[model samples]
Target chain A: MSMINYASREINCKLVYYGPGLGGKTTNLEHIYGKVSPNTRGKMISLATETERTLFFDFLPVDLGTIRGFKTRFHLYTVPGQVYYNASRKLILKGVDGIVFVADSQIERMEANVESMQNLYDNMSEYGYDLTRIPFAIQYNKRDLPNAAPVKDLQASLNPGWPVEDAGQQKVVPDPAHPGENLVDRVSNEWIGHAPYLEAVAVRGDGVFDTLKLVSKMVLKTLS
Target chain B: MAGAASWSFSENDFKQIQQHLLAFLRDSNARCALLVDRTGQLVATVGDAPQFDSAAFASLTAADFSANDQLAKMIGEHEFASLVHQGQKESMFLADVAKRVILVVLFDQRTTLGLVKLKGKGAVESLTKIFEEMFNRVGAGPGGQAGPGGTPQKGLLEGAEDEIDKLFG
Candidate 1:
């Protein structure tokens, strides 16, 4: 569900960063908090244990430049990646307008990544918003590390709808099969189940802004 | 109950009213007061918690209240009037306005519940006037066509009716 504030002429959308434990969801937010201009970003709130596992989502509201004469604000949140925290994850996804799934690229974390994605879908399904229908993107973090999955293989397995095409490749689809398929197809069907997937090292800030830009475009498009 | 006595609000009028409200809340020593649409988007917020994510709080609270509304309907209870969540350090109180916008107040346990309720009611009274104008602007703008199920006014009435049904069913 979208929230339109007539008074402020601003649309505030929730974008949750989701992934498996230690997948860099929180680290991704910390990098953005450091890089984004102070004026456009809000306080970054994190509830984590002493060892730094996220207890709840870390929230940061980023204000993108206006669109169609209205201020565009994106509320960025990161869900607790630990598997047992499904309850908190569902709480965070409430009223989310978009999602950024951060998958750790280490070969050892593949099962955890898949399980987390499946959890994301199940939680979203309970709310009647297909994970694929909402504006969303993916970031395969730890790309710079040893044993990172190749983007080609990652996209093949994660984003079946939008396969990795040359940069700026254009693809279109009509009559998307699943409601979630629409969001996936907007970028590519090859990435459908795997839509909005990107490669990056979140700790180092690779591909972060690109992911933000893509999500912003989808949000504005959804509003209009 | 005559049409001659009814009040009307315009766009320009609402802007001024909303600004005044921000100022009023600021003066009242309230940490933050949010005018949220039924969907929980913060139409306006007052006081400085620049570090606080008002937008996310509003969205989550709205989702919580909406889910509670459904729950109320399922068990033959009245529509959810308000929900107050109190923790050791923080407390959140949510109130509905015209069944369209929700007023969310965030405060420390130091603030008295009575004080928040009083100020919240005042905020709602002031906001109702602005909403009346907003309704007018939506009607007069562009094609001036009504929303689904006819005019926005009709939709507003129907929305209220639905709320009532859930409350009394």
Candidate 2:
């Protein structure tokens, strides 16, 4: 249930950053907030503990141009990653329109990522929301870090349903001469169907826009 | 104590009461306590109920109470003093505090109704001072600004205009 504010003519959408603890969800948002035009963004408020852990949530409202004469404002929030804060997380999800599940790309965080995704699915079930119908994107972040899982391994383990092209299928293409360099072809070469997956070093701003563009498109599509 | 009686009705006095409420609820065996404005916006909360959706709950509860108030009016009563909702497992007690705010208590069935009402009396008396002070602050002509939306960051009431339509005729 998204709210459309008629005064500002801005359709306000709530997009939550959800993932396991220490998955860089906050870091990803901080990067985006810093990079976007200051006039289009508001103060980023973090209610973190004295130890630098998010105690409640972080709220950052961003304006993403206009859509059909309505200023599109997205209120970005991040849930406290600690498992004990599940109750507070549930409260934050009350009117969420989209989600960015920041999955740590390191090999060790695989289990944590799966567990957190399951928790999200369960919480949405409580509110009678079908997870597949909601606008959501996955970011395999920290890709620049050492010990990061290979993209192929991550696809197989975390996103088994991911649509990526197999090497055998690539041979049938016979395009080794010039190589399929189009964006759509590249995405299809990496996935099974047409789902777009972004790899990012979020702190350095790499692939950040790609993720943002995908999420913004998905959200607007859902609204219509 | 020169202005003690007038002070009793001021928001400054209400601050003292709000501080006391925190200490009072902790000792009362109640898990959480909230002071909700007549509009159902939470003025304060105590204990570890941050997980509770205070904003949404307050808005919905205010709607419920507003409907109840209308029902009371149909029965020829001017207003409702309090509402106590008890289910099999959990119970909520809402009481009016100085006609401006509602004091809400959430607890398990283990708590006694008599004890809760007695403590609520003391809490409400203290909270009345806070509400009076808030009224003065608000009535002092918007602290030099215009109405709510006049401030750059405050559109809290902008949302309320729509909310009012949902609550009352």
Candidate 3:
């Protein structure tokens, strides 16, 4: 849900960053926190274990300037990626306006990635939120790792298109970020659309803003 | 796409809410009062709150309240209606208002917990009524659309992309 605070002249939206354990969800937040002007962000809170693993969630409220006099604020949250923390993850996603699934690109974490992705779908469904109908994006993180799986493999496993049930939206759609790649295309007998995705090395800040920018725009587009 | 519901508060609504909070503060003698959405958005604040990150406070308060609700369910309770956290110098009290928002009061040596709770009950009642009326006027429910005064300005988000680009430019 997005809140339009007419009293304060601000619009607040919640965006949750989700992924498998150690997949760099927190790192994505840290990079943004470090890069954005301090005046534009609030305190970044991390509820983590003693060893620094996220125990509950990490939250950062960012002001993305003003849109027609209303300050646009995005509250970025990263859920604990460890499996046992599903409860915490669900709580954090209670009123998500958008989502960025940070998938670990390392070949070995493929199963973990798939599990987490399925878990996301399940939890969102339980909340009565249709994941396919929300502003969702995917970030294949840890691309710098030597054992990173090929992009195609990760796409096949994670970003495989969802059925495009709307006839008006069934046409082929090109991915503006990735020339020659189609974000929505016909598969077999049905038209399908994939979540827009990008590669990132969060720790190094690569593609961090691009990923944020992409999802933020998608969210704003919804409002428009 | 799951069209996100927008919660809009007209200026008059804010005035009414703030008036209730002010009266609550005077009655409770608490240092500060914060009205927060259950989903972690800070709706309004009143009284003399200490220097702290209010946005973060709202987020944590919502999380804390939520976590406690889960705890309540595990113990066979529907939900904990309110929570009190007593510190060495100050204590905070949180209560649910119509299950839509939280009423948080921060206090210290100036007041007693008994008084805060007594006054807080009244405040919650008034706030709940206010929210119920607001929700009805806005046509808000599970996945409901924004109504009339609750709708955003036309084209308010039209040039948002250019603004976002300027941030990282």
Candidate 4:
């Protein structure tokens, strides 16, 4: 849910960075945290363990200038990628306006990517949000690595195309338990599940800003 | 979890909330108060607050209160009414206002938790009334279409691209 506070003249939106473990999600945030000017950024809080792994999420609030007269405040969050942290992931996904699915391009991490993507879909299902429709983008990270999967194969497997069955997504009928049945019915079914892809090496800050810029624009467009 | 509620607050409401928080501070002998949303946004702040990163504090407080709520559920309780943090010099008392907002009171040895909680109740009453009116106004506003003042909400990304370019430059 995006909040437009007329009193403060600020527009607040939540964007989440989600992916498999060690897929450069946190590094993306860290890179942004380092680059953003202090006046435009806030404290980057990481509720991590002694080993510095994200326990819940990494939160960074950025004041992205003003739209009309209202200041645009984007709250960035990165969920813990470890599988057992599903509970924390669900808690973090609450009221998410957009998502950046960071896919590690390494061949060895392909299974983990799919598993995490399914986890994202499943967890989002619980909150009555379908990722396919939401303002989402994809980042093929670790592209500089030697054993990276081709973007074509990644798209064939992950992207929901016109003719093929959307893996694990065919069963996404309207949830009966959800409260807004009529509203859901009224919403357009033209949600493109797969989003524009960006090649990134988050550690080096390559393609990081592009990912943020695209996701930010997509989320803001949804608000419009 | 905040479910699809876009907030629309008027300037008058902010003034009233600030007044209530000031009164709460004087009565409770606390140093500062902050109204934080569950998503870790610092809705408002008042009083002789400590010199710290308020954004960081807001995020951590929301996270702490959330973790505490889950812990309470594990114990089979609905929720903890207040979270008290004790330090050698400063003690912070945080209370829930309508379950959607948090009221945090920062104090030192000059005050006690009992006094803060006692005064916090009256503050909560006033703040709750203010928030109730605010939320009602939001409810009356058509889903993210117009604000309480009947002004059409502006598009979120209008001119944002230029701003991003400026920031990067």
Query: Which candidate achieves the best lDDT against the true structure?
Result: 3
What does candidate 2's lDDT look like per residue over A53-161, in tens digits?
8876777767777654566667677888888878666656655677777888898988888888889878877767655556777788899989899976775665554
Model 2 chain B poorest ten-residue lDDT run: B1-10
* True contacts recovered per prediction: 0.09, 0.00, 0.58, 0.35
Could you tell which candidate, 2 or 4, scores higher by lDDT?
4
Indicate the residue-level lDDT of A178 in model 3. Answer: 93
Candidate 2 CAPRI-style tier: incorrect
Ranking by DockQ: 3, 4, 1, 2
> Which lDDT tens digits does candidate 1 get at residues A143-208?
998898777676665656534344343344432323333332444245333465667877779888
Residue A121 in candidate 4, Cα distance off native in Å: 1.9
lDDT of 3 by residue, B51-151 (tens): 99999999999999999999999999999999999999999999999887899999999999999999999999999998888777554322244433344
Model 2 residue pairs with clashes: A163-A191, A163-A192, A163-A193, A164-A190, A164-A191, A164-A192, B10-B133, B11-B133, B14-B129, B14-B130
Computed on alpha carbons, the lDDT of every model, listed in order, comes to 0.66, 0.63, 0.88, 0.77
Runs with alpha carbons beyond 4 Å of true place in candidate 2: A162-195, B1-169
Deviation from native of the Cα of residue B22 in model 2, angstroms? 32
- Residue A158 lDDT in candidate 1: 61
Clashing pairs in 4: none
lDDT of 3 by residue, A1-224 (tens): 88888789898999999999999999999999999999999999999999999999999999987777889899999999999999888988888889999999999999999999999998898888888888999999999999999999999999988899999998999999899988899878889899999999999999999999889877877776
State the lDDT at B16 in candidate 1. Answer: 66
Identify the candidate with maximal DockQ: 3
True lDDT of residue B82, candidate 4: 88
A108 in model 4: Cα distance from truth in Å? 1.1
